[model samples]
Target: MFPTLDIQQPRPFDLVGSTILIAGNAAGFEGTLSITVSEGHDEVTGIASVGSLGLRQFQASIYIPDATAFQLTRIFVTIADDTGNENGPSVVIPVLFGPRILAGYSGWQPYTVRAGDTLTGIAQSQYGNADFQPIADANQNTLANPDLIFPGQILRIPRNDI
Candidate 1:
C-alpha cells in the first residue's frame, strides 16, 4: 500500500511564456508512475512517466509551455501500479501566477563591487544609463552612500526604464 503522491513547489507560479520545473517526491509502493500537467479547466499540456525498480520513491520533471499569468488553474499527479491499477492516492495541486517584471529583464544582474565602482558607475556601464537610485533601491539600500560599496558585495541591477 502506498501513501500518496504530492506535487510541491511552483504554487501559483508565474507562467507567462516561461518553462516551470515542477518537482516532488512520492512514497509507499511504486513500480512505475505517470505524471500529467494541465492548465485552464483541465487542458492537458504535458505528460511523462518514470520507471521504478520496486522502489517507494519517485521524482518527475515537467515542463509547461505557453502558460500565462492567468491560464494555470490546477496541477495533478496520478500514480499507478505496473498492472495499471490505481494506487493508494493521487494529488491535485493548485496553481497561481505572480506578477511578471518584464521580458528579458530579470532584475537580478550580478555586480561585483570593485575598488571604486560606485552604483552610478555600475549602472552607467551595465544599463548605459547613470541612474543609481534604481540600483540602490534594488539592492535594498545597501548602496545608501553610493560611495560606500565594499569589495565582493553583489548587487542586483534592475533594468532601466522598467
Candidate 2:
C-alpha cells in the first residue's frame, strides 16, 4: 500500500495485560508517525520512525494499567510527510482493552482468576478497593462462591468508580 494506516495487533475482544501491543505500519509516508490510544481521561501515545524503504513500520506500545478496561478505546494514528503533508487525525479503529477478560458492555470488565487470587484481592488490585461483594454479585453466572475462585476462570468486575 502506498499510504496506509493498518492496525496489526490488539484485535477486538482480545485479552490484554497492563501493556497492550500497539502495532501497525504507515508505509509511504515520511516525517513522523504517531499512534495514540485514548479512553476516558487516560491515553497513551507513541512514535516510530520511517525506514529507508520509504515505509513507516511502527511497533509501539500503550500501557493502560486498569484505566481503559471495559471501555471503547479510540485508536488514533497520524502521519506527516517530510514536506509537512499531514495524512491524519485519522481514527483507525476502536478496540477494547481489558485487564484479563472482556465483557460485552463497558460497565464491566473480566478478570481471569490466578492461583491464590481471591475476589477481595481481585477487587482491591483492580479498583484499589478490597470490597469483593460487587464483583461476586456481578459475576454470579461465572462464580458461585466469593470465598473461592479457580485459576483460568473469568470473573467480571463492575466498572463502578468508588
Predictions in order: lDDT: 0.48, 0.55
Q: Write the per-residue lDDT of candidate 1 for residues 1-162, one digit (tens) a residue.
A: 744455554433222123445545544334444554554454434433444443333454554443343343333333333344554455555432211222343335567788878777887888777877556655542545766889899876645234
RMSD of 2: 9.0
- Name the lDDT of candidate 1: 0.48
Worst window of 10 by summed lDDT in candidate 1: 94-103
The residue-by-residue lDDT of candidate 2 on 85-112, one tens digit each, is 4534343544434332333324567678
How many residue pairs clash (N, CA or C atoms closer than 3 angstroms) in each of the candidate models, in the order given? Answer: 1, 0
User: Which predicted model would earn the best lDDT?
Assistant: 2
TM-score per candidate, in order? 0.39, 0.43
> Pairing residues by index, what is the TM-score of model 2?
0.43
